[model samples]
Target: MPPTRRFRLIPGAVTVLGLLLALGVPAARAHGVRTEVLAGPTSVVTVTHDDGSPLADTPFTVLAPEGAGPFLTGRTDAHGRVAFQPDRPGAWKVRVAGADGHGAVVTVAVDSAALAAPATGATVATHHAHEHDHAHDEAHVHADAHAHDHAHDHDHAHTRDRWSGAIAGLLLLLLVLGVGGVLLRRRRG
Candidate 1:
């Protein structure tokens, strides 16, 4: 009876050891993905394999604003690096995937001010035109002043709209985190 019990324990120990090795080896060998924004409009993404070697030729896609369709698609170079210029302002998503179904998604935020910089010259020209019209007639001067005031108000409204959108996004994120935390606590309990 004692010999049989010992034999059973030996198999159980071997099974436990096998399970640990199977679970731990892959985790220890997992790779990491990293992204960096270069000067100007370029962004660089890098992928590394389990042994800290670059995973070259990995295919990647960039989506403008999260959940939007792909704006650009390409493969990484020999250094596991892909560069792209974000054309729009918002949260851009970069997705990299390998043949083995391993993938990563990283979000990069773009400032609206940066995108609007090129349009400043046009805006100044329009302002000068408005001033020229203002000098034409008394009646036209009154109209031009009113138009200027309206444009100023529109600018304020535009700024307010941007702020409101940002606040709404933040609130939604907080709500999601709160719900997730509650669910996790309940699951633990």
Candidate 2:
């Protein structure tokens, strides 16, 4: 009786061990897909599996040229593709993939000018454009202000207030004229 019971337990244990091996091996998928854009006005890159299927739901990030924009974060759609504009206009990179396991990265090279980053740069030839001098905001750094930056936000509120004041004055004048016209009409009638 003891031998029969032990033999039954052996079959159950073997079944469990087989199940673990079968599931665990492929479950740890260290495999992946990657994509990138080549030669175009629109900076684009794509990633796919080794089999060419779109790598869906994967996270992607674009590190634009210095002083271009903040790190752009996006996920691949059904087509396993994402896009972001570079910060400046030289050697840029687009990193893509996820880390359910290890992860993957894709880098694309394109010539771009980062007019926002505060660096020594010549636009075309003789004229050197240094952007940092005029950009006085403490929050803006060298990388961001390389191109035409948001240094003029100080004037944004001022402009809005000036326009509001002008609009209000116009509305008041129109309201006064409307009231006067109504009164005149009533008197005439």
Model 1 scores a C-alpha lDDT of: 0.56
**Per-model TM against the reference:** 0.43, 0.38
Please name the candidate that would achieve the greatest TM-score relative to the true structure. Answer: 1
Whole-model lDDT values for every prediction: 0.56, 0.50
Tens digits of per-residue lDDT, candidate 2, 14-112, equal: 798668645643432224343434323345555655334557777777775563563688787776666554444565566665676523565545454
Candidate maximizing lDDT: 1
* lDDT comparing candidate 2 with the true structure: 0.50
- Model 1: lDDT of residue 132: 30
Candidate 2 TM-score, true structure as reference: 0.38
lDDT of 1 at 155: 42
Question: Candidate 2: worst 10 consecutive residues by lDDT?
Answer: 121-130
